[model samples]
Target: MRLRPPTNMVDPRAKRYWMAGEAISNGVVTLVLGLLAFLIEPARPWLLLALGVALLIGIPYMIIMPIWRFRVHRWEITEDAVYTRSGWLWQEWRIAPMSRIQTVDTKRGPLEQAYRLSRVTVTTASAAGPLTIKGLDHEVAADLAEKLTEVTQANRGDAT
Candidate 1:
């Protein structure tokens, strides 16, 4: 029997980052709608309905998705490839072969840095281009980046 790679969830802090991002996006939409409701006197009531709908959708989404995504988002690195599983509802799994890996880059945005989180993106020769693993602790992300870089280099050298 062929065994698949085991899954590993991202850092818990990632939930905070996801929640913050979702909040900002929903807040912006709510703010813009609020402004329109106030400015357009005739459309005030209908826009208020829009505002209501936003709350109904945004509130539950903001609360549930971060937690749920945190639970489901996972990755596993084996000798041959890095396997990633992600999605809120429709889950996906992708395997990036170590031999085909072209680059391993780590990024830390302002918000992510504030939460001591970082993301690692692995670019491969395959058509998938790049696969990113988000919500890792900064140190973990850096170490993974370094390790993946070394492995890819060695794997490619062996091919020549």
Candidate 2:
């Protein structure tokens, strides 16, 4: 049987981090718009009604999308290559062979660091650019980076 990408999801805690981030961002946007609506509500009561409706719909979507993303994002390091799949509305899949990989970089932003999460970027010598796997547990990202480095070096006959 031939297996495909999206073999596994990000760490479970990743869902919480992603949801929290989404909620905060969306909440900010909603707040800004709501404030704007408040400024205009005296002139346009209908606009206030519209804004209320939009917020009612948008807030749920903002919360739901992170859960959907958590379900969708996945990655696996096979013996031959790395396989990744992620998207909510549109799906993206990436495959990077161990032999072609030049570097594996891991990064953590303030939010990610707070959540103990990191993103790993796998760069190859192709014009397609590097592939990034986000929201991994920090230790897992580090270990995966190390493993990928080993794989790349082994492919070059330098790991022994």
Candidate 3:
């Protein structure tokens, strides 16, 4: 079936959240490489080279990925289904019909909580797995979960 972009974009603060998340992960890798470079004197040159290469890669990734993701990520919920588009390079689109949805849940990791953001998960019987709408405001995610739950329950079907 043909699909177009969803109607809503995720919260704008998600950009900062994504950057911070990538920064933390990249920071850890840099720290490890730096420590190894200092401690292993014989391999210092190679380690430094590795660190430089990592920075070259990580710096651009830290800058670009979040912006690209922000541009790509979108979600929309209607009376009949929930639609989402996500990912940066490897993009995905999903639609969960109310009749097929088995569960609706919201998730907030420590970082997401710090950013006051949440992810909404809609599980269906499809083998492809649950559909997620990430980077939503916490309150909005909760309301969306509730709305989806209500709609799915009202749909008269086995949710198969």
Candidate 4:
């Protein structure tokens, strides 16, 4: 059976947060290439070429990826499970059954903190690893984590 997209989209502010983070990381790579161009006299031309190429690719990636991801990224929680859809080029859809959930936590990195956003991570017994719902409002993520924790505790099972 085909799965439908999750019901809720991530916070709208996530787009700006994603773009800013990508720009910073891409900028760092470009900056390193530029510095190397200045430092190495013989390979200066090659380094500058690489820097130009980086800008050519990075600019579009910085702009387009966030927009695409904003449209794709979504999440939802029900009494039975938590659902999430994430990624731009390669999509991942995850469902963590309430009974299988081992832990639920919220996290905010420096960029997420700056954007006032948080991520909710749900760990399960499956070998696939934790499922993360990113770009949520900080308060919403906290509430989700707490609610999931409570539900998981009540539904404790091996899910075998």
Give the top-scoring candidate (lDDT): 3
lDDT of 1: 0.86
- Write candidate 4's Cα lDDT for 1-160 as tens digits: 9999999999999999999998998889988998898899999999999888888998999999999999999999998989999999999999877888888889999999999999999988888789999999998998888899888878746654
- Model 2, 1-160: lDDT tens per residue? 6546567689887877887787777677677767877787565566666667877877787778778888888999989989988887897888877888888899998888889999999988877678899999998999999999888877764222
Q: Distance (Å) between predicted and true CA of 143, model 3? A: 0.8
For model 3, residues 1-160, the per-residue Cα lDDT tens digits are: 7788999999999999999998997899899999999899999999999999998999899999999999999999887888899999999998877789998889999999999999998899878889998899999999999988888878876788
Q: Model 2 lDDT vs. the true structure?
A: 0.82
Q: 1-160 in candidate 1: lDDT tens per residue? A: 7545347789999998988988898889889999999999999999999999988998889889999988878888888888887787887777877887888999989999989999999987666557889899999899999999899878734331
Residue 42 accuracy (lDDT) in model 3: 99
How far residue 127's Cα lies from its native spot in candidate 2, in Å, is: 2.6
Model 4 sits at a Cα RMSD from the real structure of 1.3
- Regions of model 2 farther than 4 Å from truth: 1-5, 39-50, 157-160
Which candidate leads in TM-score?
Answer: 3
Better of 3 and 4 by TM-score: 3
What TM-score would each prediction reach against the true structure?
Answer: 0.90, 0.82, 0.96, 0.94
What C-alpha lDDT, on a 0 to 100 scale, does residue 146 get in candidate 3? 90
| lDDT (Cα atoms) of all candidates against the true structure | 0.86, 0.82, 0.92, 0.91
